[model samples]
Target: ISQGIIFVSLLIFLLVGSLNGRQRTFVSDTVENKTVVEKSVTDYLASKFNTMVIPSLYCIVLLIGLPANALALLILITKTKITPSTIFLINLTLADLFFILLLPLKISYHFLGSNWLFGEALCRIYIASFYGSITCSVFLLMSISIDKYFAIVYPMFSRSFRNRSKATFGAIVIWILALFSIFPFLLSQQTLYISDVNITSCHDILPREEQNSYYFHYFLFLVILGFIVPFLVIIFCYISIIWTLSMNARSQFRAKMLSTLVTITFLLCFMPSNVVLVIHYSEFHASNHSDLYVSYMVCLVLSAFNTCIDPFVYYYISDEFRDKVR
Candidate 1:
């Protein structure tokens, strides 16, 4: 396993090195030709990141995520009894499955040098489904954490509040909210023909004026609704749960691991992109320059990893799942 990790790492480094050089040459050649700079050189960083990193990361996510999420769903249904937690877990697993299923199209898009051959309509649906699944997963994780928090922190009083019907209702609300979050993106155009690059770039390239006028505000709204709100709720719930667990009894390893893993993965996957997005849109919107947009795109690669790591999160949270896996 370690050998495989090392091998993938080395392969990525090689791809990054070769692709970056080629990108630099592409820029120089374009400049020499005196063709209008269709896209800036910094934009190439995102392109390079997409070409080298997205395919590899997404491939790994696809390979592991498909079977992991599928098995998680199967186990939750067959091996575990129905309950609030089970309902939430099942929904969460389904959310991850939705996210994972969309990755192959993304992998192909990036591997083809960011040319989105899927046409405009498919691109819209693709982006919508991508963000929708992720947003739903985030809210569902918060729901699960809250369920755990109440069950652990106030077991007696929490009984009425936590039930299968309530869980199902929460899942429905989460899915609706997720769809709402990405609705603006779905309605907007996502494909652009770059005459210089001679490719139809997906959401990566958009008209500067439209981005500044519309997308900047829309994406910032997304950051608040999708990332900020859910994260704060989940973090607070986890902290309270941790303290309660530590204070009332001996620290449970699995419980604590679940908390730590969720927190770390949430921050690792979403924080960078969210932060960079806010900064880039706020500061660079009018300038029409690539202010950390490459970094933003690169950070997005980490977000897809959340789906890959989510099934393992089920392992830590569910005793039935743990035993079944073991």
Candidate 2:
């Protein structure tokens, strides 16, 4: 699975590197026409990337992520006793499954050269589900880390708070929060008819002037809450877990290995994309496309690769999951 991820990353880099040469040349020729040039470059690159790379990658993710998560969900649902951690994993699996199931629409849109054959309402639902599931998944991961921290560090104290009912309630709250956060996006006009291209776009184009301000603020809100806070929480929880385990010589090696794996997995799946999103938006507001935009878009899709990684994490790390599978 890790190798598959590395292969995808390398493929993206190679494809982007090839395109960058042409993009730089275009930018150089139109440097005198700054505003027009920036808009043109942004549109050109976005269209190309969205049409060519994104659709194919989404298909790949759909193929691998769908069945893996479905099987994991099946095992957890039918074979496992409900526990807090298992509940969290089940919710995480559900989020990934739901998100990827919606990818076929995205796949169709991109495959049609970034055209939206789907109606506006369906487009809004697509946009909402895509981001909402991602937010829910991240929060669920944070919930898992906190659960682990308590289980390892303060097992007795954790007993009262960590149970299937609380886990279910927490998952419900996360889903509600995720949906509410993206409600504005659903209300906005997500699909745009581009007369020039003779196609309707589903949510990749920049917002109109009237909507731009709201989008800017909303983008910042998502970055801080959806990515940054959860990242910090995961780090804190895992670091505490490692520190507590270090005192027990018998478990020291296990602690170090788990810490390393968790940190690497978390960073590999999310950090690059989230960091690049912040930079991309900063550049967007300045009406400049960062040189990193291509990489940013690539990383954004790469984050969805988490769907492939999460099931493996459950099988290997969660004994309940493993037993259920067995």
Candidate 3:
């Protein structure tokens, strides 16, 4: 988990640093005759249309995922013997459910051609909802890995110390951390003004000069807290688990299987965002020619895809889920 956090933190720093880098103008001779503001609007409309495609697909999955996850949560709660891992999964699913609920607002924002009809307060809530979902997902995954680490490597100690109450407390702590981490979106400047066309946008609309600073700081923080830290912990736990299982040939196969699943889960959920973030940063800082905003839109789509893929990963990788299905 800590390794994941570190990875995310580095990407965020790269993005934020790029944002604070020297400003590059997007306008060229061809763009000059047209209203820059209107062009921005038009670009946004096109981007919005593109953004709608993935989220719409995701909404369908969420439709299935939310209820399934809810049922799973209920089952876990009713179990006579509940594990710490179940506690983490419950919170993870809860966050995902909330995430699913917010998808409509996001989808609608794009469907309406990038015009944020939801106003400032809702805009803030929208951003927070998205950020909170993402942060909670990362932290909860980390917590699960930690629980697995203890269960496998220190079974008796875990039985004594990692009981239901501690598990619930851990989940609470992760949620609180996520809530605090994403609160900044609530305080951020969400509206962008176009002086040339008398219009406003709900996207992070810092001025050109300030945009870089915002990105630099935001990216740096995310890299540290979001990716780097979580990834490290996840990797460390898995390593210990693998080592412990390997000492006994009977469990070696299971350890390998679990390691493979964990790797696939992390790669599917986090790797795309990491790559997209890097590309987006490059595009942001590129001087004369690149379409940075387009790059950002692409990254945004990838991030959303990450959100959608999570439920499937959860279903497939969870042994508890499989047991229940049987």
Candidate 4:
């Protein structure tokens, strides 16, 4: 049954990835005086489709993730052995819970047709927590992969790395790094200003050129540092672990299963958004009205829901908590 669920989840991820890849976007023409451009109705439909999913996912996060993560936290904190591995799970649950707690602010914003009913202060804090939790989650997952690598592949060296003190320190470092990383969003983003349209949006409200420049630089950094570097580390660690396990008398099945789950989780939860980001930033400077707007919405929804799926990842891979769930 667990294997079936894992397979279905992978299939869902692949479907989402394929759909994202098929999305058509509009890049601006360099020609002079091209104010109006053609936009496919299909792109518009895709945007609406993406936006629709956000609320459904919001329901899951609120109705399902919140309680599940909260319960998991109780279990991990009160019952489970406080190994470095479990410490990371605890941090993961905390991040998920923190992010889930902030979902109403976003759901309300989106349900109101992208209007920011919450004032500027919350806009900043909520957005910070949003980005901060996500960054923390990714790096923590990377840390988990690192922990498992040592534990499964190098048992002798694993002990030195698995202490409670070091994991706590690592958690603090991840939080601090995430906090600083999102600091720029608070200062730079502002409510959209348009005299004609009395609605405020909570993102880059700058001129097209300026916003694109800022997004391009930062998105590039995230792709490299946030996704790519962590990805390479995870792949290397898991590959080595798998190689070592195959040579050992142990089943090696669980190690392979965990690595597969991790890799698929990253691909589904992180890779699509990262790819969309690269495409979005590259063409953001050159986007026309129709296609550009739709693509933006799709990217936004995908990025926001990235954290929403972490619960499933936790449930599937963590042996310590799996039995507790049953």
Error of 1 at 258 (Å): 2.7
Cα RMSD (Å) per model?
A: 8.0, 6.7, 5.5, 5.7
lDDT of 3 by residue, 1-326 (tens): 43454466557655654553222223222244432443553464446344576456656655765676666666656742466777787788788778877878776665655557767888888888787787888888888889889999999987888888999998999888888877677887676545453444565344444445556566557656886678778878877887888778868766666656665566555654554444444456445322444544555555455545554555544677656656
- Across 2-51, the per-residue lDDT of candidate 4 in tens digits comes to 34544675466456444323222332222354322233522333344434
Ranking by TM-score: 1, 2, 4, 3
Name the Cα RMSD for model 1: 8.0
Best lDDT goes to which candidate? 1
User: Model 2 Cα displacement at 299 (Å)?
Assistant: 2.0
lDDT score, residue 165, model 2? 89
**What TM-scores do the predictions have?**
0.84, 0.83, 0.78, 0.80
Model 2 C-alpha lDDT versus the unseen true structure:
0.73
Estimate, for each residue in 1-326, the C-alpha lDDT of model 2 and write its tens digit: 32344456446544543432211112211123321334464465357676788878888898899999999999988888888998888999999998888888878887787678979999999989988988899999899888999999999998998888899999999999998988977888776655545667666554335234657678778878987788778777877887888788767666666656665676677767666555544444443443564665577677788888889888656877777777
TM-score of 3: 0.78
Q: What is the lDDT of residue 122 in candidate 1?
A: 94
lDDT of 3 at 257: 63
Error of model 4, residue 150, in angstroms: 1.0
Alpha carbon deviation, residue 63, candidate 3 (Å): 3.5
Would you list the rank order by lDDT, best first? 1, 2, 4, 3
